[model samples]
Target chain A: MKQNRTMVVIFLTPALLLFFAIFVYPIARTVMMSLFSVENVTSSVSEWTFTGFKNYADLAQTSLFRKSMWNIFRIWAVGGLVVMSLALLFAVILNSGIRFKKFFRAVIYLPNIISAVALATMWLQYVYAPRWGFLTDFFSWLGLEDLAATQWTAAGNKFWALTFAYCFGMVGYHMLIFSSGIEKIPHEFYEASSIDGASKPRQFTNITLPLLKGVVKTNITMWTITSVGFFVWSQLFSTVTTDLDTITPMVYLYLQVFSTGNTVMEREAGLGAAVGVTLGLLVVLVFVLTNLLIREDEIEY
Target chain B: MSTAKREALYRSRQLNWRKEARLLPGYALLILWVIFTTILIGWVAAASLSTTRAIYRGEVFDFAKNGLNFGNYVKGWNSQNVSVFFMNSLGYASVSTVLLVLVAAPAAYVLSRFKFFLNHPIQNGFVVAMGVPVVMIILPLFAVVTQLQLLKQTYTIRLLMVVLYVGINVPYTTIFLLSFFSNLPRSYEEAAAIDGCPPMRTFWKIMLPLAQPGIVTVSIFNFINIWNEYFMSLIFANQDATRPVAVGLYSMINSMKYTGDWAGMFASVMILFMPTFILYLFLSEKIIAGVTGAGVKG
Candidate 1:
């Protein structure tokens, strides 16, 4: 038993060390950096002046920060609900003895695999292009030409465009999850329900949904985490727009530090770290809260 | 008695009609959605082949005049040194994925099979790691990489990228493989060990083959992640030569003003997008199975 413990430690050490250095240590550093005022990022002497809660106070006052927080919530609410619902609907349909299921599944999942850059570029040129875009044409066909001519990445439309982009990419994975969950439901139950003259919707509500509770919980958790930490997609879709239009907290923080004209400026590192710490805490808080609210007993299949 | 029988038959027919009516809308909605998604993906393929001029003219459905031009592809491949970027991405993604599988497989095996102290904590730790946002790590990682002089050399930077990849990905890969490893029959490993096979040999020869499907799934996922990664590569590999295709395409798009060649940009995107997209097209079943299967057990 002692030998087994030792072996386990040996196997785990490398991964643990890397995780601490790369993941945990950085978070600690972000907190520490947030407390100081650095003249320059690279060569500044570390004079730690403890400013307890000052950064948080400043964050609250910053409109950009507040706007970003609201945007995050908005995207999660709209995107999360739509994507999960559509995915579940599609999954149920595909699982119902449908022909060409594999082909449809492949078509849906294809977008998820495309590189973010490619996907973003395609959307920008083909769908959201101000002049002569397909989406505009479709809108004209629907007598909504004025709406199509409006800038998609603009603040008014940025949220919806970003949400649509996220949902399009996510539907495939979530659909598969829901489909597998549905597949696990025993056929005997459906047969028995039909024997009892229970309608399809009735069986679905009583049997299928109850059986799929675990999957629903899992999907919700996954989507919540992914949505909260969303960075790349936001960056890709919103970079062309005004910085304030769809600036997520992470991207805003990144721009403050790296993309700003002078890296050696007095304002970069400490402020960037402050933003980072705030974002991290927000993410952790959301994750814990969601889990607590949705916590349920594990259902064994 | 005859009237009672007629009434029962009429009731049965009514029930069947109502059931079929309810099913019609569901099937229609599903079919419509499937067709809509198919048309969109088909548009992507057509756009990849069309000239920028044709696309700008909204000739998506009019493929007869502007169909199947290889000019854009050739230009995309040669222009902006994309071939180098492609090779760099291939090298980085392949190496990183292979290393991740190598490091993660044994760790997953030990975590799954043993009942040692800290076992549950280790698993929980990985779950927490999955929630750690990557943005939080970028600053400190930049400092560490610079301090270690990793940024100066390309090969060292790539190696560190692999290590970073392995570190972040181990959580998911280990968890995924853990379930598969645990599901295998214990008797196979026991028999091999009893037959004078060493422990390592037993795992290598017996357990490894048994876990091939899980390994393949994890590897494919890791490959896609490493290939598609953008932010880390953007930060670490500032040089064009060392940049992967994701960053390469970004810079290409950024430089479009100077080039004024929209066709070139679209072509480059198509080139960068093809390798993974084609793999997805062919192996979608495997990919979906891998992801869904992992989710179920997890």
Candidate 2:
């Protein structure tokens, strides 16, 4: 028993130390930094003037910051709904005894494995580009030439375009989740439903869906948290239509800190920390809310 | 009477055919969606292979006029720093995966096998950490890295990345392996203990081999997540020689105004996806199992 305690300490120390250094300490510093105002580009004085709640106050008043907060909700609402619906649909189709099930699954999942940058680029060049992209040409060939010329990633269409892109990239992964959930359902359930003269639609609505509640909850939680934490993809693609400052809150903060060329200014640091903390709190709130809504229940197969 | 009965049976068969016909529209919609997806993917592949002139001419579908060539691939490979980018990704992902498994396996074993004062709280903490945003952690990490002067060298940055990856990944890996380890029958270990084999020896020889599937699943996940990670790599390793393919591709795209090499950019994107695509083709079952299996069970 003594040896076991020693073993636990030995095993856990490295991970705990690294976590404290990388995860815990940095968060503490961010909160502290958010309380100060920048004095210079390189360094700040130890004479810390604690501006109580001013940073948060400033953030609330900024239009760009407010728009970013709204944009986060818009993206999550539209993108999350579409992705989940498509995932459920595909899961049902794939779960139905289809030919080439594995091939279909692989094709659907291909986008998930590709890097986010690559996936975004592929969408921009092939599907959403206005002039020479395939979708444009296809529409033009169908005599909707003007519609074909509509810029997809332009400011006018950016929100829908971004949402679709997010959904398309995410559907395969969530579909795979739902499909596995469906696979676990016993064949007897379907057989009994059919014996009782229940139609396919009825069976799906009643048995398949309720059985999949757990998987759905998991996917929703994942999507919500990840969407709130989103920085890279939004920055990569939306920057085309949106201002560098008008992207997601996280990207907005990132640009403030890192986009300065060569001159390390500390002014943006405090503001950036303020933005980061706000975004973090928002994400945590969403996670907690979602967790509360998604109550745990065991489904017997 | 016999002729009438035969006619009635044939009528019932006709009604059944009509019932099956009602399912056709759903199937048709699925097929149509698949076709659309295929066209999009094919167009991207063709764009990657075409010359800039062909692309400008809007002859994307005219494969006969614009045959495939490796020129774009060569240009992309050279211009995008694909060589260095690929190496950096490989090193970071491989090193992180190895260390994650090494730390997580033993930790998971102890948590599952032994009862401790803080076991439940530790488990809960890991679950909570899973939801913590990477953005929340990045600011602090950036501050820490700068203070440590670890950002000055590529090797040091990579080492820090490995440690960070392992640290964050611990919660998931430990929880994952915990279930597997605990599901293991305790009788085997008890017998080994009675036979005078030390606990460590039993773990190395008996439990490790038994928990191979869980280890493989978790390791694969760690590998994929690290490989696909863009944000951390973007901030920490933005320098050209150390950038991973994801960040490298982004920089290449961002430089298009200066370079005007869209074909080269697309080609590199295709190349960057190759490893992941191939892995998906071969081991999709495992990937699916790892993701959905882990989530549902947890």
What is the C-alpha DockQ of each candidate? Answer: 0.42, 0.44
Q: Chain B alone, TM-score of each model?
A: 0.87, 0.87
Q: How many angstroms is residue A112 displaced in model 1 relative to the true structure, after the best TM-score fit?
A: 1.4
Q: Give model 1's TM-score versus the native structure.
A: 0.89
Model 1 lDDT per residue over A56-136, tens place: 677677787788778877777788889988899888878776656787777777777888888877776657777656577
Chain A alone, TM-score per model: 0.84, 0.86
Each candidate's fnat, listed in order, reads 0.47, 0.54
Can you write out model 2's per-residue Cα lDDT over A1-301, one digit (the tens) per residue?
7766787888777656655665677677677777776432123336446786777787787776677778777878888888899888888887776556777777777778778888877777668876677668788899997878888888778767776877888988888888888998899999999999999899999898878767776787678777876676787675643453337777667666766553432345667778777767776676577668766566654
DockQ of 2: 0.44
lDDT of model 1 at position B28: 81
Question: In candidate 1, how many Å is residue B50 off?
Answer: 2.7
iRMSD for each candidate structure, in the order shown? 2.7, 2.7
What is candidate 1's CA lDDT for residue B205? 80
For residues B244-286, what per-residue lDDT tens digits would candidate 1 score against the true structure? 9998888777687256566566677778788888778667777
Provide the TM-score, chain A, model 2.
0.86
**Which ranges of candidate 1 are over 4 A from the true structure?**
A1-10, A38-47, A141-151, A239-242, A262-268, A295-301, B1-23, B60-64, B257-260, B295-298
In angstroms, how far off is B135's CA in candidate 1? 2.0
Overall lDDT per candidate, in order of appearance: 0.75, 0.75
